[model samples]
Target: MVGAGIGGLCAAAGLQRAGVEVVVLERADEVRSGGSGLSVFSNGIRALDALGVGDAFRAVTTRTEGLRAGQRRPSGAWLSTLPADAVAELRVIDRADLHGLLSDAVTAGTVRTGRRVTSMYPNGLVESVGSGTAGARRAWDRFDLVIGADGLRSAVRTGWPEDPGVAYSGYATWRGITAAPVELRGEAGETWGVECRFGIAPLADGRVYWFGVRTAGIDEPGDPALLRELFGSWHRPIPELIDATDPAAMQYLPIEELSGDLPTFARGRAVLLGDAAHAMTPDLGQGGGMAMEDAATLVGLIAPFAGTECGDAPELLDEALRRYDELRRPRPQRVAARSRMIGRLAHAPGPLLCAARDLVVRATPAAALGRQAAWVHEWLLTR
Candidate 1:
């Protein structure tokens, strides 16, 4: 495995648990120490359970009670109310916390840091930075299987260019966690307004995780004051959250979604997972959760073929990749389209469109909402 991000770590966990000798190569000196937070939906937890880390995750996370969806009016009146079940089986946690958990579970000597994978071949061979003495040449190592769990800008993906690079979603997101004096009453909530959206949830600690997004054509400016100025007046607790944020800790990035064409996941003995396979917008907080699912699925697919005919490995891997694409593609595409549509509706030009959209949200039954997400949340890898 190359890239020690969440996807790589999870894949390593699954493969190692199945008695596979796995070596994870990471370019960074260490795991990412700082990231905002991630929502671990029930499906993601189930995937962790399959890997035997679900209980540990639960111990360090907080289960969301419910979600409060509303729309803010130009005059500051909340014109919408869509109360969702708090016990929707979704939990939220800091990225660093989850990374620590996975890192701890990994067997010693399986993960090598600061080793950059410079290139890869069709065969099961990869070249990475080797130890050198006084400018002497170094040596590279070979593995049976190379899993590319690298993130969106994956070097493996670049090595074997697949679909045209990542597609920009015309919007950017700013994420930060802040101390909250009041406890969050529900799981999480989102407030949508014209071309702007704000979401907040309480973490296991007393801090609240919040993300503010707006449709912008350019790269994020990465200024805390700008985030404050844009979303300061959205609603109660928003400005408070912003004020409580450490200016230096705020992170910003433009949202980008990968095109769903071609089979770039596996070329011969190498395979790609997580964001390397499909990186969608965060309109739905399933990005990390989906990656977790991909890890588990990939492990299951490969475990059945261990020690099989060497000639069959490529065919088996291809079948697994196809199944992965079949199972993961539709749901994430739906989520991406839903997120984009919601953004459009939230940023509608006239009051009439906004009113209509709010009406649909209000009229939609909570049970129906749950059913809409059932296909995603109720997924079980056991089947």
Candidate 2:
């Protein structure tokens, strides 16, 4: 694995459990997640269970169910919500905590930090860079298979001649976790306004994870106070969430996703996974879930090779990878496209369009929204 992000670490855990010797090369000085929070939908929970980290994942977030979540206006009026049964599959977790859980699931010493992959091929030949002055030179390793989970700017994906690269979503977000436990007051979900949205949810540990988003340029001011300025007057706890967050820890991120289409995710003895393969806007909250699903699907396809030597089943591996591409690629692309559309709707350009959107969202039946939620959250991994 060429990256130690969630997708890569999850794959490492499963492969090691299947008796495969895996090495996860991470470019950072250490393995950690940068984001403040993540929404792990039902499919994601199932993926973690398949990857053998489900127990820890659930343990991190004790409140697995019963979150009455839906959209709200600036006045805090409920817009529309899936029925409790539909939303039962949703759980919010601190990204860093989940990262630690997945990291622990992997075998000790499996991830070599500060190692950057310079080049890779379909035949599993890899050239990596080290951190120190003496370690600057390229070092080579050949493996039975290579996986690129290196996020949006993946080196493995970059080497692909067909790669379309990434483009900004014309929006930015500020995410933060409360320094101390804050009372959720039984409130959760997103509050929407013109070009701005505030999402709030409680972590299992009582700390609240919140995110504020607005349609804007990447270089157009991203200060934490921008979140306050944009969302201060929206709602009650929304302001409290922002006030409780330390300014230094808040994250300002510009949303970006893959621009064009890639012919295939499986290329030679190497494959792309997670954001490396399909970097999507976070509008649908499926970015992490899709990555987890990818990990589980890829691992399940190769599970038959457990306890066998690497490269022992080249033709079979090729066939399985083909299937991986066929099975994994379409759903996420569809989801990504859907997310983009939702982002546009959520961040509609003008007040008139925004009003129309709010009216449509309000008039839509909760059950109708529930059905749509099922289409995204009810995914099953076929072995």
Best by TM-score: 2
Residue-level lDDT of model 2, residues 31-135, one tens digit each, is 887559998889999998988889888877865466768899999898887688776767888889888988888889999988999999878999998874336
Report the error of model 1 at residue 327, Å. Answer: 4.0
TM-score of 2: 0.96
Error of 2 at 68 (Å): 2.2
lDDT of 1 by residue, 82-167 (tens): 44542357787888889999998789888887777778876867877742321223447777677887788777777885645778
Question: Which residue pairs show collisions in model 1?
Answer: 65-86, 66-86, 66-187
Clashing pairs in 2: 122-269
lDDT of each: 0.73, 0.88
RMSD (CA, Å), candidate 1 to true, equals: 3.3
Q: Candidate 1 overall Cα lDDT vs. reference?
A: 0.73
